[model samples]
Target chain A: MSNLEQIAKLSGFSKATVSRVLNQSRHVSQPTRDKILAIMEELDYVPNGNAISLSKGQTMQIGMVTEGINEVMLPFLNSFVETASQYGYQTIIYTSSGDPKKELQAFEDMRRKRVDALVISTCVNDLALLGSYCKYGPIVSWQRMENPQIASVAMNQYDGYTLGLEHVISRGRTRIANAYGRPSSINTLGRIEAYEDAARRHGLAELPQWSRTGIHSIRQGEELVREMLAVEDPLQRPDAVLCSNDLVAAGIVSEARRRRLRVPEDLAVVGFDNTELAHTLGITSIYNPIADQAKNAFHLLLAKLGGACEPQQKLQYCLVQRATT
Target chain B: MSNLEQIAKLSGFSKATVSRVLNQSRHVSQPTRDKILAIMEELDYVPNGNAISLSKGQTMQIGMVTEGINEVMLPFLNSFVETASQYGYQTIIYTSSGDPKKELQAFEDMRRKRVDALVISTCVNDLALLGSYCKYGPIVSWQRMENPQIASVAMNQYDGYTLGLEHVISRGRTRIANAYGRPSSINTLGRIEAYEDAARRHGLAELPQWSRTGIHSIRQGEELVREMLAVEDPLQRPDAVLCSNDLVAAGIVSEARRRRLRVPEDLAVVGFDNTELAHTLGITSIYNPIADQAKNAFHLLLAKLGGACEPQQKLQYCLVQRATT
Candidate 1:
């Protein structure tokens, strides 16, 4: 059957009236409107959601909140925005500058703006405020989550770290040091556990000075590696170094170059979250499924918006072997 | 003068009444309200624009149309959103996929949602439809603009290219090549002009085989460099290569590594945009003022929303010399 005939039969209206409604040319009577609406529901007709939302005083817009914007957040943000746009929703963004007060303010403002949904990738553990916003709209956690009330799409950080450690061990490296992130962060805890577990499993001694934790930055990576090299005992010097992230790993590589040390020969290096920088540097690192997590976050939010059952989603990670390993 | 007393005198209301009104605890008569409002206006009393906008039914929300949701756009988007949030306004984003049709749809959706203002970074020369939306609310261009009616904040692309090219020439390299972007893009055209001018200034013979143009991707950069190197003319081969952007330069670097060529010794390479990848690779490149452009665009939109005169703004770029040079 033709589209016009289908619409006419579904709406119980004449073809001319259905055409008028579809074209948005003129107003139809109240009874005709009710009949057409019923038919549209029965036919499962999907009109342009944007146009419908526009007429209904809502925009179907979602909000994305994160820490300070940088190259690190680019890939994930892009994926989330593009995927959400495909679903006929626009995205609003907020950056917290790593300040707790600023983060709270962003959440309050986003809530006041009445965004249809929200996705937060924050470092703070105060999830109560975000949970309050969920009462008004769906909230999806990205990477970090402390509240079970909110749905989350997160990476298996422990597994990623384990994979990286296994790869390093397979290369016959017995003496290893780790440059990790802050101990306060949940991601850091996972990595620390995995690193220790891998050492125990391999029957290698875990040294106190070798298990270093600090902020994830290039300078920190350089400093940690320098400290490791400065150890007076030649036996204490590590044969390999594992970094918290790609930026840190790049720093380690740069410092190694400066000191004329050959990577994977003098000291093998590994990183996490195989970012674009890792790809450019040819550094072997753990590849977290960032785009996949973002896609799943959007899908989870959509499910909540549709009043569907919620489930905990954990994305997998893999070790991408390269020159550094 | 005390804040309360100043407000009281400015509004021509008693201290008690002023306090009551400020706290929204009591109502005043219409005549008294008119007198107080006139007095406040005469004194140039500045009430919070955010509170007033909220009370007037405006959502205090703005929309940003981005080119892509990748790393390049992340820093700019984050800054824009943070700044807008400071003014108690939330930002809605639309990713245009670099397609004019998707861009138009974003504008239509934002317009239908009655967004107070918009900032567009994705360039689409044709603005007839966007112009119609501009009449209803403020619309500011972020990176590129072809329409005279829309206000824009742009980076000095020519100046940036000039600096990058001059740096390469100053290094005393006679045979220089460039891995440029799409010929249709204005930014690419500027870089090409700068490349030609710089080559002539250095008294180097320009070779057609050495100059390459393609999509801004690592694979394209690798392929183009390979194709150029395949030419049998030994004397015509360039001693130095300049990439249009950091990603392309990285690809060239990777290819060079594959061919066992040492960077800056066997072949000097430079890149544009000085992104994080450039820093990680230690590649010398120009720094485009993405954040500045975004900030300026938001302020321009804010000015227009305030019913003030808007001016065209252009930000300057800087050259960052790194290890690659």
Candidate 2:
């Protein structure tokens, strides 16, 4: 007889009772459970994978963790949701609020929900903890991290910035301005690095007064420009600006108009994300293939969950020049 | 003894095998399965709800269906995701490209995946079809429909336009233009009705040239204006514009600058959705309290799924005037 049958007989109970106990059923009395568990332990009984899967069937779910879906995330999210469903998997969303404790809690909740995998975006902190979650299941991110277990689909944001910088510099924009979301974030740091590299290469001086950080919204983007305009020194001001997002770029453009600063002639500008606002306003901006990124991320998670691991995916990006440059 | 016990004894099999057969296990022989099923039918054995929930335990997953997320849905989506998670439920996103067959297919798929509930946004054509899906589980929408089975949290989008109309009219503007996503959509119709009402009350002429349909984007907003500008009759052109969305409003502002039209002086403009772009561009717009709408929709779904049905919620709106008006 098999170990299960032996345990059933030894415990003076049916196989159903032993099975229920293994599945962690509360109906089984403490004495009966203890007796059956001891017998199973003595026999070195291990529950089969089929039994576990039968109890916890395919949820066909992929959980998404993000730092609360913001403007740049919205379009990407729409594409991700559509693309993920197309892949025969349902997509679940969890907002982590970028808090370490809250992020870990969200991860734990996703695990308990038996999500097939997780796709995270812009993890400002708690990356190590997030990386540790890969052992539990497939984990993919928007960052191109070095870890092999955790896969990612990332845009060439840094290189895209360089292209933008070169375009603006070529336009004779010597005093360049820029903005950042979280100055400390790896994404922001990398972008800042590329800007510095491009500036040094082009022999353009980096003015501290021109760059701003901690800008979170379009209003702030306008305020950032207003602050730039407030400075008394004519030579200290930026001849052109590059924004972290299109919303901010739109804000800067609006504010520039309010001050009667002619675009391109008075001050050239560029925006990132290539959102609808960019196309509408005719602003030069970086176009990250958001839909492609979503598709790649979904496929990456699908591959990892299917037990075929792939390396980190780096998606392409470009500067879409309109009238702003 | 219970029917299950009687069926097991009559089949001359252990309860485990009988239970497995009922749960659709392939381990049992055909003869055994037929015999056991026959016994079960004869005994009228009914499986309890706990058994089903155990098999498809609270995936805690709520599938969301939308007619493809767009610019207007972004703020609502962000809040919906955050609010749903706050109420101890995870959110799943499914984008139906507004295709009737595709939407129904998505619904059936979500049902197969055993999502606890579904929340839909802007069902333009497939509403009745979507309404029929309430029988499977709880269905909530971003519309306050007459169907009770499909609970909703809707915005007063009609009143929002009226408010916009009144604000601009109060500011001594008579020739007003408006645009929409799908001109025939219920949302657009309601807004149009309010616009008509407000126009009559204000004794303003309804120039057919001023009200354009099928304005899908900001570029379209500008195109609408350019089309207005093309009209040889100066009397037919609008003195102010009321846009379907803030992106469109921003576009009008951009286009106005291109034509050297001073806003609120030459052509005042108002927008809906009150997005960051609206505030950035200093456009007068309608604020729909999207976060509140999202929270109410989530709670309504929560109540219905938790076995207590709640009435549909109608969220209010307001006109926020800025430099543009």
| Model 1 agreement with the true structure over A1-325: per-residue lDDT tens digits | 9656998976667999986676666578767777876787786564543344434534467777777655556667888888887877777777777777777765554444455678886645367866876665678887656677887777657888888889889999989888877677667888888988998999999876787887578777777667766877756788888888888998888778776667888789998888877876788988888877888888888776673444545567888989898
Q: All models, DockQ values?
A: 0.29, 0.22
Proportion of true contacts reproduced by candidate 1: 0.52
The candidate that achieves the highest DockQ relative to the unseen native structure:
1
Clashing pairs in 2: none
Candidate 1 per-residue C-alpha lDDT over B106-160 given as tens digits, one digit per residue, 9 for 90 to 100 = 6665444446778886655467668777765778876556667777777646778
Worst 10 residues of 2 chain B by lDDT: B46-55
Q: How many residue pairs clash in each candidate at the backbone level?
A: 2, 0
Regions of model 2 farther than 4 Å from truth: A1-57, A307-315, B1-57, B146-148, B307-315
Q: How far is candidate 2 from the true structure (C-alpha RMSD, Å)?
A: 13.3
On a 0 to 1 TM-score scale, where does candidate 1 land against the true structure? 0.81
| Model 2 per-residue lDDT tens digits across residues A25-62 | 89999999999989877875655322344456545667
Calculate each model's fnat, 2 decimals. Answer: 0.52, 0.49
